[model samples]
Target: MEEKKMGLMKCLFVLFAGGVIFLLLLAIYPFWLLFAKVTNLIGVKGIRNTSGKLQTPVVFYEHSVTKRIVAFVAVIHIAEPAYYAAIQELIDSLKGYKILFEATGKLSPQEEQALTQKEKDISSQFDFIFDLMKKINELMSLQYQKDGLTYSASWINTDMRLYDLIRAFAQQDISLIKKGRDIDDPFTEEFGQTVARWFINKLFSRFIPVGVVLSVVAFFSRDKRVAKRLILDARNEIAFQGINEYLKDSDIVTIWGAAHLSGIEKCLKKSGFREVRREWFTAYTVRDYSLFDAIKKGMRATKEAASAATALKKD
Candidate 1:
């Protein structure tokens, strides 16, 4: 009888240990995404606020008591950088649902190459602009290193490029800027200087109306409000596209900033989704380091390691 009792106790101990290990694994599973979001240095957290009410983290789903639609939402707030693996996990989880990502537009091949060159080029004339942008990105990265912070450098670049593009269009000699025939310069006397202004404005607006409008709006209006409007419009389009393409035939999942999703959630609610759910996904935050800051941190760590090694040698 004593031997049998000892055997039973041993079996219980093994089972308890296994259960504890499994639980710990499950808890830390979300951290694995640190590689994609933080390591790659690209990605945003989805977060939003609307109607004076903050959207909290809650999983939304729809079921009809006896049946389920198998649809759901998993929101990743971009306040903190997201891991690429987290994105993959999000895609896998929502594999049952259609996926829509609210993000900055992709750079044109030429634009991307140009931007890369701009970063690498050592130009005395453009150093001021280069340093300004580097500083801005560094600061932005640091702020976003905080928990619940999501950001997209792509969005920042896009806005800057669009503004620059439109300004160039507005200020350049349009007829001659792109190897086109010059408009009769002699006609300026007939129409007056106002004609020149009107002609340029019209040309700029017609070429890329969105940028033109945004530029003009920005000149007179606050920047954040304009960005919010643009993001809202983009969110609506993404949601609509997803619903139209996948709602009836397949499931969908979307990744975007939390702020953008408030608009999307509203769209989903109005579109007859009985229940909308959200899940708060988290990853370790990285401090946004400036070029200087990164260098400093590296040197500090190296010095510490060297000091420890010297101590060991003396001992």
Candidate 2:
């Protein structure tokens, strides 16, 4: 009976795997057709090509909102050796200035207690995901630095904090995943690990790069209503610090995440600040390899985009 049961399990696994492969194969043609059509759009063409550099993805935009020029240096957080060094370098490079940082705000005692309970609840339901994120952040050095930054943090806004929204999203993700899962499934941890690995691999797949993901987020971020309000309050922080102090040569530098850059830039523009200088630096390394690989991929993508655009023009 045991042998028979084992055999039945093997057969079911094979059938499931085959079905998944078949669906993927069926998806390719439609995806290709869609990609072909999307290449013709004007702004999309610039993004699809090698116009951007291969770095950890940092932007240094100069804003003259105050009497002194303020440099809003936006960066995406990454947990890697080089990423840590790049952050330090950024801090070191901008000396003798009042630096305003994007800070996670203090939680009320009740909120803190609720968060603790949520952490416990999350561990019980999605231990694998929580543990993995924790490990990755630790490995990548992905936490805010107090001593390294050498500055007091300014809340992007007084009324809202980023962590509060993230907690809400965490609950939402938990609820969605739990509702979709089967009660009798025995491979809880293993299943979670498999899905996480597969999803990340798909993101880094040859056809769809991480840049494209960021571009999508950046595009939607233009709408303040749809995008998370956490980063949206960057304008508030700029105003709060900008109004607080000003000197003939004093510069207020804002070190925030790249995801918030576009929105922050838009807000700065509204406040009459113009971009005086811009520079890019690496923010995250997708692969644990040399930066050359990223550069080569960028070049290849640009070549492909250019060819696609030319073909569309001829048509």
Candidate 3:
């Protein structure tokens, strides 16, 4: 009888586990779609899904009358790193243009190559996407600095405290990884790992306090996977929110991760925008570090808009 009872309990446990997984899938599926829509509105494009008909990019060309509305979406990656200008080029080709402009941040071939390596090398895990970003930034800065140009940080914004914490956290994480420590390694008393973590979190907490808190939570919490997923979801929210806010007044042209951009076209129409456009802008081929020069040249256009006060002031 005890054996039979034990078997029944095992069955119940399995069923409960299956039910929980089902509920999670049900919640994440719709949310994934909702996120796609918002990301599409600003300029994420080229989405395909196995489950449903994906959204397409919107392009509006209005003239003289305000009746015309257009939202442009462009999905970008290492292959198509130059899509950041796709929408702007379209708008400029026309005469007497007035429209709202918004864009997701650019991901260059150099950055993409770093991300791919980080992803492929399970031995070297990364925290946030920006963790990889800082490495590529350093690499790019080196080339430029050697060429007699000084570069600050790409993560810089209005808040100095928050910016420092983010930079420090990124610095610590990247350095640790380069030293060959797996992400899952337990902290040792001799290593003073907690001090490093604390320095990063406390210093940068002002810029991204949520990120710092979550990092600390991940450090202490056992459910690190769930914490990571929550952080990613938060990043998606930030991208979507930033894109939405930018679209409110300008003709938006955005380039963000292709995975994130998928299925966002539908959201633009629902938001009262009309006629969106999307296309393949560029393709990225995987190469080595020596190819950094070509990749940097491809991404040099970022400097033009990167210096725009009007765009920077929006965020």
Name the candidate that leads on TM-score: 2
Model 2 residue runs over 4 Å out of place are 1-20, 26-58, 62-67, 105-132, 138-227, 230-249, 286-315
lDDT of 3 by residue, 1-315 (tens): 999999999999999999999999998878755654444443323433212222223334222233444334333221122333443365455443233222223344554455433343322333434344343333323121112211123211111122222333343333223344332232232122333333322322122223334556667644454434333343444544554664445444433334434333345445555553334333222223223443354345345545575678987
Model 3 misplacement above 4 A: 1-73, 80-233, 243-248, 263-269, 285-315
Candidate 2, lDDT over the whole model: 0.48
**TM-score of structure candidate 3:** 0.31
Q: Candidates' lDDT values, in order?
A: 0.41, 0.48, 0.38
TM-score of every model versus the real structure: 0.37, 0.52, 0.31
Show how many residue pairs clash in every candidate, following the order shown. 34, 8, 25
| Candidate 3: worst-modelled 10 consecutive residues by lDDT | 142-151
Best-to-worst ranking by lDDT: 2, 1, 3
- Flag the better candidate by lDDT, 1 or 2: 2
Candidate 1 lDDT, 119-210, residue by residue in tens: 32312223343343343333334212223323333211112233233223233312111222223342233232234334433332222233
| Residue 152 accuracy (lDDT) in model 2 | 39
Ranking by TM-score: 2, 1, 3
Q: Write the per-residue lDDT of candidate 2 for residues 52-121, one digit (tens) a residue.
A: 2223233443455444555665544433445546666775677776665665455556655667565445
- Candidate 1: worst 10 consecutive residues by lDDT? 173-182
